[model samples]
Target: MEFYAGSRDACYEAKSAGLPKASGGCLLANASLREGQLLVGGHPFVIGKKDSGNRSSRDYYSHKLAWVSEKFVVLWDEKDKRGWLVNGASALLHIVMTSLEQLSPAFKSICLFDPASIQEGKHPHQPDSATEVLLNINNRQLRIYREDDGPPRFQGQVEICYNMLEKMIEYQLIVLERVRNSRIIVPRAHLEGWDFRHLAQRFDPIYPRLAVLDTNGKSWVDFTRSIHAVTLFGRGFGEIIRPTGACSAWATLPCGKYYLAACAADLQKIMDGHGGQYSTPLRLTDDDIWYIPDKSTGQCLCKDKTDATHSDLAQILLPSDMCKNLSLNPSGCYQTDRGAFIFGFNEIHQWFWNDTGNPFRKMAGESSDLLLNPGISYMSDSSVFRESLGIEEVRDASYLRLVPQQMSSDNYTVGIICALTIELKAVGALFDSTHAYVPSPDHDPNDYVFGSICGHNVVASCLPDGDYGTTSAALAAGHMCRSFNGVEFYLLVGVGGGAPHTNKQDIRLGDVVVSTPKGSKTGGIPYDTVKTLQGGVHIINGYLSPPPYRLRSVLRLLLKSDPNPPKAPLQPYLDQIAQSVDGCGYPGQENDQLFDSDYSHLAEAETCDSCDPQKCIQRTLRPSTQPRIHYGLIASGNQVMKDSKTRDRLGEEQDILCFEMEAAGIMNTVPALVIRGICDYSDSHKNKGWQKYAAATAAAFMKLLLSNVPVSNDRGQRQQAPMFSG
Candidate 1:
């Protein structure tokens, strides 16, 4: 290679621009080359120029920018078959070179330039005896094979052997021989600097045949057929078959066969054993499967019809104390074992038990390893799949992503656990007039609640906001941040507008509204009474949420019997709320209906003065006929229903016992319950005056309910507690 001079100013300019410095000014920038384009520097460039000058054989070589350093720029060309650096000397000098035709297909050689400054070189390379070579693998190692020679001659004689002649990517294979022992074949990459002891940790001694298959079987093609089959062997069972090119293929051992396979790739290779090549030719096939024959069966011993009964399963498995009873009601397949409850048509996954004890209460769906056709599911309105599902090869498109309609709720479904995280963003009063008070600093935020009494319930209120605007924002933030980690069936306890009947029925100003699942039946109601009144009415409108069976039973019992209704005295809480409103700073609006509504004039015999609350009721609002707590249907929609007309419209359509906010958002996200205290008539009369009192009442009721409920502790049991029995 000959030395040539370019421009002295140009060299200084390139150096100042963060490029390598040279005696010649600076190499003019390749205006046509993109940032990542490959190029050769110094010696290769000088050689190319000389070859062209001589008019002899034009150097048939492709140049590539290996990397760049501050003082020196490394470059490679096929013709020179060596790596060289361009420095300030303007001399063609070899630095380090690899005897190879092309770079590894995995990582391409590209110019490294600082995006911040065009003149600055991209990569930082330093002088070192052994350069840290990054091999871009075109083909991955597939299998490990071993051969035994009578009395091994060389012990720990590691030989790096590679089939350089093959068209496929050239990968180094390490062959280690133990004197008079078997020859071990492993990929040079995996065994490099690997401690034999550490390597042994990964290999199980009991399982002689080591098996490494793609966890996310993304490749549709059989592995036995892939041409890029890299094999390794460890005299005995220490064979580690790792894929070098891509981790998409699935590997399996054939029945009664000792050899592992990379059967999918089209390339064919023979297994070289201790004596010679293995007798059987390894090929990729659908039926071919391999496993390290274990004395212990891999089958799950949870006890079923095929093996043990519920009693046997309960005893054989640990944590038997957690399991209570196995209700094999319909069939043995869908039986409920004590610890883990399986709910499905048969063995097919319908849904599994989210045992309360489990940190993440969730149910996993069936997953596949196919890259093209990934698995997916709907979780709280979000599409979920897995990405990069395997060991970084075969790109995984299957990832779980959630997109909720109501981002305000800050609600999201937890994919790992198959549960919803509910945020109770707002539970406040936007005071109209009527002498109602606005939410203030003095008010207790704990007045809000979300949970269940029949079982486990959660109730909470927003932290105080110094300013109303700030308070509202904080409340929204809090609700949006309301996340249920793994609890099953989230509940919301708060206040809502309630219609007052002639006799006030059995409900009072501070009663509870144990809402069913959004679309669940409340009494005879279908639960999804959205638009108009029909033959039967449901509790909620908008997105439907079916209440769990346990709640349904409890509510039914409460409705049937109201002999001793209003179990707790909510009067004190109500009175406190009334007084709090008196301190609010905001003035009443002229159109405030709170002042105009005549609560005293509306008597049992007379009709409602403003909006008729009764017209909204699809059916007669009868007092509880059952002996349990009074549980009525509630409605939930995105919009806050304050108008008596709209309330009546929804009521007549769905027979909603109360109207409140947050439940729809909560229920849609998780297993949620709504407990609302009757504050207003849910009509035009809704005002701030009732908010304090209603909130207090709701809070008290929630405490009463929480004290009496119990949740299952088993780690794999489905939530199945009954609500009531009317």
Candidate 2:
């Protein structure tokens, strides 16, 4: 075992023998020599001063000598002639020695009286002067140390030992400094005259605090106060700068050399080899060691060398642990060392490093002269950069489409079908707002208008101009269903011929008629069906389904209520239609005269103006002038019911309240309520004057009915009918 002893007598002996005097008037034994019996008496030895030309060497040697002499001490008893004290003044020496002994078996077996194996060098007292001692401590083979006697020898074993010992002392100082001021000094070394312009260009955006220093310790460029000082040392040289908070140091090789040393170019080469982009930032820790091939043709980046493509280049080793407490991140930074020259794959922040100063302020200052000129004031109003970066291309108009397919199904639940344009206009005016139109692939040219009415999204559509009858209505309903997913219920709102029966009901002109179930038929009855033999009896073919029971219950409740809430007035909607379209004005109650079912009018007359009033059949006087809302089955067919005889026959057989051309067609596709305003008595004396007024009354009643119906949350899905049995 090796031991060290120091005393006041030893300090005098060391000075007389040309040895260095350590702190506290003591002399230090050669710790590396492992002397068995160390005497406390003084011996002459000289501690040489470090060269002033190398500041790093001076600091390293000075600090390391002071620490080793003060921390560890061994003493001998001359009278007993045996080694007694280990660290004579320190109370913690036993604990430190016990921990050391537990760490290594070699330490446990070491004897302080005899350390001949450790001190085998020829110059035992002057261990630093012996080249063999330095080589042994540095783990170099004894044969190589004996053979190499050139200047390279000075740069090898001795330099390695100095660096190691210097690092140990520096670590202790770093811990002490960190406690005093939360900062540490990092050592760095780099190549001579290396160009850092490329590295600065890429890394400045990510690491704004980066600064480069030249070999003379002068900064390469002026930097702001916010920038951190990054010292760059020349090859094989290092220095301890003032403690800066969280700082890093980088080492580089000499100029024109690529793989001889670790530098920025080596990191760049790794990035370029891997497609110049990373999926994640690469992190390099201080303790990591990376090895690069000395020659350019070597397989430095390849994971394996099974193809016999290995190069004869010597390996360049980078021991990053020499610079302690560093975490290097290669994100947007171009010059970063990643172990084994492998680039990570990650997103990079390009402008994260150098964003300290305001670039706009510099630009404004440069153009101050132009701004001062009165005639050049317009230049400040115009921005060339803004205009260049603005959107410039106009989108194609052909891409725009306005159709029902673009409407959202979730927004609408009620679909309104109008047989005439006037009918569509009346209902459309009740809508709050129209939605954006979307085009459908189907060739149906029906115009669809979307709006909300009574808290429900209502889509009103009209049959193409000149199109009439149940078949056309069926096609329009199918197209609407495909475009809007499917509607909850359809409101067939328009004018229809009144089927007034003497014993059944007192239906009159300009009154609204809501379709309801009667006996076997529900909602609207298709009167055009041809009777066929079924079980030896005539049966109605292609029977239409009834309107949803929920809607029917609401209608029944409204009809049974006293005074029917006075019917929501339709005059406002009628006036809106009149202002927008001519001839859609109210045709007046006088024009709404209901002729007897047996009366027949002149064939060529457009209105009752030229017709003889004496020829028109008169009706029984009604009690009130106000329009009434009637609920009964409405007869729908393909043909217009202009003949009084056919209308009466169908009315008596099916108990129909009104006759309309489109209801049968729509009822086949969507379950709906057919609301009609009686315009004529289903007789030959039919006039076109009362059609608009009748259409308006029907639309108004529809708005009232919708107000009473609850809004449903049934998107496009089918809903079960509410039970009406109770």
Candidate 3:
């Protein structure tokens, strides 16, 4: 056991004067030695001050115990001296006393104390210190005591008392300053040249805050990375800067060399574009440690400097104009008029007359400016970047596509600018600049029109003969074509008649008479009877055609704009037919009934050009302008009637309005709706007036129908794109 007691500010002691060297000793290793702690042989002692600079050395107190072997120390209780002295093997008092006589004079003075004195209960008389007392041993115990406890009284034998008393006196003498041996500071006189006092003023006049320090730690004012044996109070020599008006000096840790001891926050300000000479500190790229200059220059003078890398910015275009005037092979490099350049490839060469001829490659042997080859690069002729430069290489620049200035007004001013990729398939053969073709109606086994249905396209074909048969055949063909093409509607256009009718009739021969859902029995439609029934049959009494709901709105607007709707002239021949058909006598009682109807007068005579008695004739053809229109139903049959009896019977049986030869053949495949300008009664009294005027009426009516039919695109919600139903 070992113990400690009294105030921490105390002297230390040792024992064992003039004795044989002993093997063991004990100490209060945790706490610095304090006064009144019992030493070997019952002597009291005190520990010394740490101010002597010996606090850091392991051997500072070791010299006092030189007589003992390094490994052995006896533990004893400072206050309760009755406890056993712990040695490796028990020895007699005589042996221990003799061993103490062999110790060195210095070693004889050091004391062995109890560690338990440190545990003395807190008392008013004793001032407390933070140091702890540790007794190092195997199973060793410590004891603590107050000064009033008096020196420890040993419970063991009093034999060899004089020798023990002698050892105790020597133990008390062992107390010495704690900092007796160290090496980190210089005497005050040695720091005279350091100028630490005038650090603020002696610094460079312009670089006011800059001060120099000897990086080597050879003087009191100097510093090193660590403390040496000479350190002040056993610590390193560090700089202490005490600013004016400050009670305490601020300390900075010693570094390998001089270091700026400024606030890291202030250092950051210098690096952030502040107006200071050392605005930015040089940094070691790998580690973030900054090298602040000793002098106030912005540059760093450290041997381990750093390294780094950098980047830039740029625009693009071409060299010259190459439109129409370009030759096959030109001499020299055919530069763009602008001279800004890039190498050209076959892809670019192919596009020489592309979107807006931007000559890319020029051939050799032709004039460089006038002609171009197939492999040179040139400027684009488009004015997209016109403000930059002008291109003039003697080529027809006008050939470059010129967009109308009005495009901006309609918001379509933008054009595509594409870079060359690979060649496109040769598709120009199907188009003549204006129209782009897909598959043809003839070659296409599907029987589809070239363009129809979806409404985005148009289909155009010609009729060799312009008559009801040809026209009706075309209409039938068109309807069939539309169905095959997935077209949503049909348009029948060309010419037709304007006729007089009995319902206050006053229609001109040439003026258009558009069909309005009119058809008579033998067959009839919902659209026919609902609004068109009059005098026992469906008939058109006016010129306006029935427009599909969607197109009707816009067509109405167009019609409203026409100021002379009623004054438009009628065809001369249609007038003659109307007059003739009105006078023609009917056959039998059926004839009387026909004359009794309002549309009987409207019926014009059908005229046969060749007067062939074998073929049936058309009464009249309807007129229209828009191609999507169709005339109301006309009769189709095989009988050619020259007799009044047959004509009246035919009329009575079929309620047939106008007769024709081909429509029935067509109706088998197409949904037919015939619009006939009533031509004649088809009796024995057919006249020359019937032939001329009927033809005229047919032509006029055809024109009228065409004029009235709504354009397909304007028809009710357009049909969707066709999918392959098969």
Candidates' RMSD to native: 29.8, 37.8, 47.2
**Could you tell me the TM-score of candidate 3?**
0.23
In model 2, the worst 10-residue window by lDDT is: 350-359
lDDT of 1 by residue, 121-175 (tens): 1221212201112111111111112234111211111011111111011111101
Flag regions of model 1 displaced more than 4 Å: 1-484, 501-508, 517-543, 553-630, 714-726
Q: Model 1 reaches what TM-score against the true structure?
A: 0.27
For residues 291-403, write the lDDT of model 2, one tens digit per residue. 22121332223334355332222222222332232233333323343211211110121000111110011121233222111110111111331122121222233211211
Best by lDDT: 2
Q: Quote the lDDT for 103 in model 3.
A: 39
Question: What is candidate 2's CA lDDT for residue 143?
Answer: 21
TM for every model, in the order presented, reads 0.27, 0.41, 0.23
Residue 545 miss distance in model 2 (angstroms): 1.5
The order of the candidates by TM-score, greatest first, is 2, 1, 3
lDDT of 1: 0.26
